[model samples]
Target: METLVFRFEQGQRRIPTAAQLVGVVSSGNLEVLVSRAELQAACEIEVNTAAIGFAPIWQAVMDDFQARWQLADVRIAINDMGATPAVVSLRLDQAIEACLESAP
Candidate 1:
């Protein structure tokens, strides 16, 4: 078992507006937690195990989301359990929805 840890501080202008949540549990299972903070929405992720040498792929997926959504003031934390890149996006969507529900 191995672990990877990282953190990001998002501004209030990077939060998503009306997001969705979705992911799969085959070869790639994701568990996410999202919340509305003083800035906006925050995210944290944890991955149990991965294919190794795939940081660039992960960064690309995350970057794509940020660019497409124009998220502002959103903090994200992710934990992946040997999940594929697609699963990451799915879990992210799910977490985003959770944020909307919890948003004030």
Candidate 2:
């Protein structure tokens, strides 16, 4: 399968996280989880955030995720700590990339 890869972090702070994809957590204010799901299951996105007013923004992020990846049977869980939409998107992409790269 051809996977989309990206450079999550730049400079010396970049750490290879592909090996830690399984149950791996990323970002400080925004924690994201990318894990495998049953083949028959659909892509699941669960977001727990304190900012209730950002529902639309969150929905957009979910939509973007669906469009960007073929996540027919993947589970993505996110815990947001007042992060902006851009940050949320970045973290999600990083998490997915890590998960795919680590797949055996």
Count of backbone collisions within predicted model 1: 31
lDDT tens per residue, model 2, 10-57? 111122232233222334567876665443436666777766666667
**Cα lDDT computed for each candidate against the true fold:** 0.55, 0.58
Candidate 2: residue pairs that collide: none
Q: Give the best candidate by lDDT.
A: 2
| TM per prediction | 0.58, 0.69
